[model samples]
Target: MVGEKRFRPDGRKAFREKEEFPMTETPLAARDRRATAAATARALGAALLVLLLTVAAAAAVSALTGCAAEEPTDDGDAAGVATSDADGAIVVASALCSEPYEQATSTNQIGFTVELLRLIGEKSGRGIQFTKAVNHKDAEQNITAGLPEDVAAKVAAGDAGLGASSITTADALEGVVFSDPYLHADFSVLTKMDTGYDDLASIQGDGIVVAVQGDPAIAAWVAENLPAAEVVTFDAGVDALMELSSERAQAAIVDEPRYLRYVQVKEPHLQAVETIASDKDYAFVVAAGNDELLATVNEALAALRADGSYDELCESWFGAAPERGTATRSAGEAVQDSTGA
Candidate 1:
């Protein structure tokens, strides 16, 4: 058959007048056009993907370099820089050489607790000073002399600013308020490795000579728990450790962190076993009357927690951030300082 002629809908001839074009079942020109269109579509898709990846990478970069919402602010003074306040200055009385909490060299003051107090001062524009309390008695004396009111008197009189360097007890909570817990230390019992005492229960009937300093809480706990062992009280935990090293005491019950520090120095052949008791929560004591300062300190502590400073302090000292909890009543216990300054 002759080549079929095509016409437009407007009745104009569609085929060229030069010659009738031959037609095949599938035209190579149409196939080529389709292939070109597909290629163009793929190129466009790849270009769009590249654009998306580039935007995502830029966002990741911003997140890594403190542009994210939770990024830490780097401008705040973190080291132990003194802060000044409206008052002449807030004098912070701290025991100067306690390890894991406060420590100092000939030229530097460093530790988790000291740094925390410094941060608090920076936040409040308050000046803080570290003092050397030779012993618990010295600490108590200094606290007694510095404040116009005594803790017990303040409890009786319902005033604030009467806290001493002591542990908080349920009874004390009745009359005084404790600052945020600055430190939490576990108590452990140390014995000569050769003593064969595997745990606290094993030493119950063994006439274990436990040496401790003036910490009455530890003494009380021992008295109530290890009724069979004879607990010998000393002037300081370090003194007790010295006695144990010299073979004066068969075992020593002391703060776990402090015991770790002591063994490093004395090199005593001792083993430590810890009893999971309530953590020793150390806080600043305030007289019942000075609610203002107590609130201020508590607010400062809250700020420290929000800013990651508190967790940083915890990590520096305890190797982990402390779990936060609600406020509860803890007071009215005997005061003793095992830290020998």
Candidate 2:
């Protein structure tokens, strides 16, 4: 009866019933197909949510790790010059003072300070660039009482990492820090052979002219120590020496190294007559509160000293290793003598 033709109440001829098929081959109803499609979509949506969450977590972890790796540790590198780049290059300020210590020969800078700085760079694996903060003509013209203000200002402003113009620690101003002394020298008097002045005392008298660098301290010292002698100031030691050579001034006061280089070696007729002050210590000067830079510089200096590089530099520049522990006057005494206090 299920497979036979069935007739409706008003039908002339009813359609025959279709044959049934296996369960696997049976077509699903519209409602059942809709339910199956919805379930598959939900499963796919859950998988996609998991994948997005995993990717987000991985990105967060990577960021945190990168930040940790970039953090600097405490191995004597704490604070640095604000102007320095990531490669650790630094700018050094200097003045063209004298030969064998600091000088501008053509476009290249070659001198004791230049070589020493290069050695430091090699040892520390850092790059160094030098700039002349104090012009030779200007430094020669205006000598200040304390540390040179322009140099101090540059370092304070982060324009320079250090000042290396044969600067003495005694010349340091407020908010400036000086490294340990790498070279020591004395103030001396230079005169022509015919001047017949054997010492500083002999050259002192009324109408006797003395030429000196444009350093207020040095000028003050001359005024206080030699009250009877007339003082003439020049822009630099070389200029002062020139005054003596030209016979414009009977005597010249300069540092020991300059006396040895310019008078003894260059001008054989000039002679160093007397030692005025013997305790000047030449060092690199940095802005105050830059402890990290100071530490690194000291470390490099100590290494140079230990490895005999410092001695080599001294010999190359001065023809011998510099004498250490020499007796000299205190800073106060020196300043007082210069200021006539």
Candidate 3:
């Protein structure tokens, strides 16, 4: 048919005339018209390819010469370039060399902080990634101290958003922000079951060695409360408690819930003497000024509890359901210094 548009066998639209032609038009004339159309299409395709190649080469030269581009960080990521997911997923960094709370370095990432990060992502409808460090304090530090420059840049870019670990809500840092506390806990003094070093008073004597986690806050707490005791700090809470097993330390100071589980399940030889009076709240943490991330994580935490997922998780980890999250209470209940949140 004359002037009938058509498509190629490959599904690309072929350049065809839609104009009407006289019935007297001959086959030779039609063939000439088709040949001309084919020639024109080929010319257009060749020009488009050249244009694309020119643009690509310009971009490559500009990148290599550092034209208006930020330098790569020590970690090899561009300082200003975002390493976050294309789908806007956030990363949660942690380094808690501890138990129940951290249990880091495991393939399963079994622990309170890691599981909480997972649930928060699920509830918030956001993708989440976990970045493990050598220890948790460094994880929190990354949110605050501006180390591993790429992460700080990522936070600003909204790619890296959280500092997950057994991060207490207390001790607000300049660059770190806290979500509502998902769990409330008290400090505790744990001792060997047969050591007769059960209470704080028993371990407060001069030369009484108390094993404590390297968390500056807990270490500071031990220093303030037990002046006469020789404080030995371990990199991890589990390691500190292990010192108690060898009589290297008479007592171990740690979060009440973690030690409770440790005593009942992992190490029956340990006893939680008693919980300290002042309570602390464990909360999800984000970089300071990350208002959007903070709000999302808080909402997810509340929903996780309201839907009973928090309870089930607690049962799995602690062997019992836990009390209501301190978020339902006053934020005032948290210690305002290195003590609590």
Candidate 4:
């Protein structure tokens, strides 16, 4: 029987003997599996966070860049894209609407600003357009009041355009850029022919009230200079002239061109005496940044003066050629009486 029962040598099972051994699990394997899972999750989270931060950073950069580039700068030199709040029209605004400078019926705006700008437009191959007021004082009021939104708006928005008016003093030169001096206006005090006041000093404190056309700029200067004179105000030059002629006011302050124009037609008894020549340098005021357009306008004005077109316009208005030999004439030189006193 021992020979028949052949058992395995050691711990063997072969239908005669059976042996079992213990299996010990490794702690390192379990730990390694858990660490791998954690690492994968962390990698995913970090990638997602990086994506979110990149997106946010891009958004912040976009926000920092503003819309200023899309709009025209305040200077009138913009030949590029124009701001489109209004229609795409280049509007030229002026202070004169009535006769001599401008009229509803008259086509020539020669002596005044409208014609000069119109000529500039014509030479530039662009039909210069216009928006007119009753007078320079009216235009100034419109500028201050913001009545016509587009013309005033361009100035406010700092676009490449300007309104036609005199840019005379340092204070007036603050907000707008001035063109080359196109004309000079003589300042004078108008009084009834019978009024004995000969000079500014004679009229001061003489109980002789002076009528001034309601131009705050000119009026302010007059007020500062002539402290003793009582100033009466009027809506327009005609009204001021009427006041002086009617003796409602003893005197009125007016420019020589307008005064001479008035004396030629209206009350001949009204005498405009030389108190002080306004010595005005009339210019176009463009949007502050448009130095290029200003330069262009100046260049064109110079050309017009050289070619005799400006002289022709002046001759048409004053019945004589421009004595200054240029479009600009100083008020004092143009209006001084023959006596020079």
For residues 1-341, what per-residue lDDT tens digits would candidate 1 score against the true structure? 45557799999889864435555436887899899999999999999999999999998898786432221122212322222122424444444444545656787667666677678777776655443323223744543222212333332232212233433443244545567776565565666666576455677775677787656677787787678777788644667777677767777776654555565445546666543244566676554555555677778889988988888766555435532221110121221222311
lDDT of each: 0.55, 0.68, 0.63, 0.56
- Pick by TM-score: which candidate is best? 2
**Reference-based lDDT, residue 301, model 3:** 83
Residue 93 lDDT (model 1):
41
Q: What is candidate 4's TM-score against the reference?
A: 0.54
User: Candidate 1: minimum summed lDDT over ten consecutive residues — where?
Assistant: 326-335
Summed over model 4, clashes come to: 6
Q: Which stretches of candidate 1 lie over 4 Å from their true place?
A: 1-88, 94-112, 130-164, 167-176, 245-247, 260-270, 287-289, 318-341
lDDT of 1: 0.55
Query: Residue 77 in candidate 4 has what lDDT?
Result: 30
- Model 3 residue 309 CA deviation in Å: 1.6
lDDT of 2 by residue, 184-298 (tens): 8766667777667645667887788899976666776777778888888876787888888888888888765665556434666776655555567888878788877778788
Positional deviation of residue 132's Cα in model 4 after best superposition, in angstroms: 6.5
**Which residue pairs collide, candidate 3?**
95-135, 95-136, 169-341, 170-340, 170-341, 175-288
Which ten residues in a row are the worst by lDDT in model 3? 326-335
Which is superior by TM-score, 1 or 4?
A: 4
TM for every model, in the order presented, reads 0.50, 0.62, 0.59, 0.54
For model 4, how does the per-residue alpha-carbon lDDT over 75-170 read when each residue is reduced to its tens digit? Answer: 223443122224333445544433344444455344455677777766654555444423223644543222223333445344435565333433
The root-mean-square deviation over C-alpha atoms between each candidate and the true structure, in angstroms, is 19.0, 18.3, 16.9, 19.7
Query: C-alpha displacement of 24 in model 1, angstroms?
Result: 99
